[model samples]
Target: MTGDTVEAVSCTQLAYAFGETRAVDGLDLSVREGEVFGLLGPNGAGKTTAIRCITTLLPVPSGMVRVFGHDTARDRMAVRRLLGYVPQQLSADSGLTGRENVALFARVFDVARRERAARVAQALAAVGLTDAADRLAGTYSGGMVRRLELAQALVSAPRLLILDEPTIGLDPIARTGVWEHINAVRAATGMTVLVTTHYMDEADQYCDRVALMARGRIHSLGTPAELRQGLGERRRAAGTGATDTLPTLEDVFRDVAGSGLDDQSGDFRDVRSTRRTAKRVG
Candidate 1:
């Protein structure tokens, strides 16, 4: 991002460990305001850990994370209120109605009592869930479940929307629907989006810029086209055929990640840690 652009999220020398495993180490990153930024990497590449820290789902050291200039450690609530997060796992409670779920988050984010109903309705409508708002979430399709979760996040009307694998386990049609809602909301509100995804094409098409991360560090950062050009240059320098056609984001991931994808993780996150993070953030 340009130096003049406002930073929605910034991390400097950020580190996190689980027991002896270092999940994130000395990572420095900046995301510009109102940009759809993609964080791409394979499983165990520390993307989840890094975002968990940024969202204050895990305890972070002072001076490490700042969300829109609010230090996450010093102003936890302030930071939390400015960001809405959708975790990778299915978060919608099957037993509760969609309205009930969103209303619960509205209260958690401290929406005023009188405005909670309006806010919830607006959020549901934003995600195309108003028709299903009164139904149990379990009855919704996989795609609708994702939309319901998006509604839960949007009810807070956050400046930054953190989406971790937002389209996982959905059909291509469903995926498109989910993104349509997201794009509409972003266009309407200018919300900054920080997303981590395994689908390279989605990042290539939707993200303004992407950071390729592996082993708790960012290996490459640029617009998708710029990074692809860099990869082609490197290929030519290595005495290989460099095609005029732009490379895909997946190509960039494989090149930058190197041995990280094939090797075991130096970073580790267990089920217990995930549960802990959910409890803290929820």
Candidate 2:
């Protein structure tokens, strides 16, 4: 990003550890204002840990994290007020009606009491859920449930939206629906988006730029096209002769984190949790 480009999120030499295991290792990243930035990585590459720090859910023990010029550690509430997050785990209440769920978030975010109903309605409409807003979330389809969560995050009218694997277990149509809603809202509001996903095609099609991480650090950062072209150029220069077809985002992913069999790739617990989320949403 250019020096003059506004940054919505910035991290400098950020590091975090779990016991003796380092989750994030001296990472530096910046998400420019009003752009969709994707953080792509295998499990245990520290993507979630880094996100937790940026969201102020975890302390920045070793370095700095800033959201829209406010330090996360120094101005936790300020940072929280500017951000709307949808975590990988399910956050929607199946027992409550969709409208109720969003209204609850509006209260949690301290939306003005007078504007709460209007904001809740706008959020539901933005996600194509207004017609079903009064239905209990337990009766919702998987796609509807995910859209409800998105509505919940949007009720606060946040400046920055952070999504952790927002489309994790959805089918192709559902995934596209989620992205369409996200893009539509972003275009209308100019809100900056930060997302982490393992789906390379989604990253290529939706993200303006992406950072590939491995071993708790960034290995590559560029637009999807740029990263793919870079890999093609390197392959041609090395006389691999496999350049008959242009490389893909998945190819770049493999190039950055080959096999993903390293000890730091993830643990049994990580596997279980990811599977659980996928199953629940499935």
Task: For each candidate, give its TM-score against the true structure.
Answer: 0.90, 0.93
Q: Which candidate wins on TM-score?
A: 2
**Whole-model lDDT for model 2 versus the true structure?**
0.90
Clashing pairs in 1: none
lDDT of 2 at 8: 98
lDDT of the candidates, in the order given: 0.85, 0.90
Task: State the lDDT at 14 in candidate 2.
Answer: 97
Give the poorly placed runs of model 1, Cα more than 4 Å off.
1-5, 241-244, 263-282
Residues 154-263 of candidate 1 have per-residue lDDT tens digits of 99999999999888767898888888988998999999999998778899999999999887788899999999999888887786754666667878887877563454
- Candidate 2 pairs with clashing backbones: none
- Displacement of the residue 219 alpha carbon in candidate 2, Å: 0.6
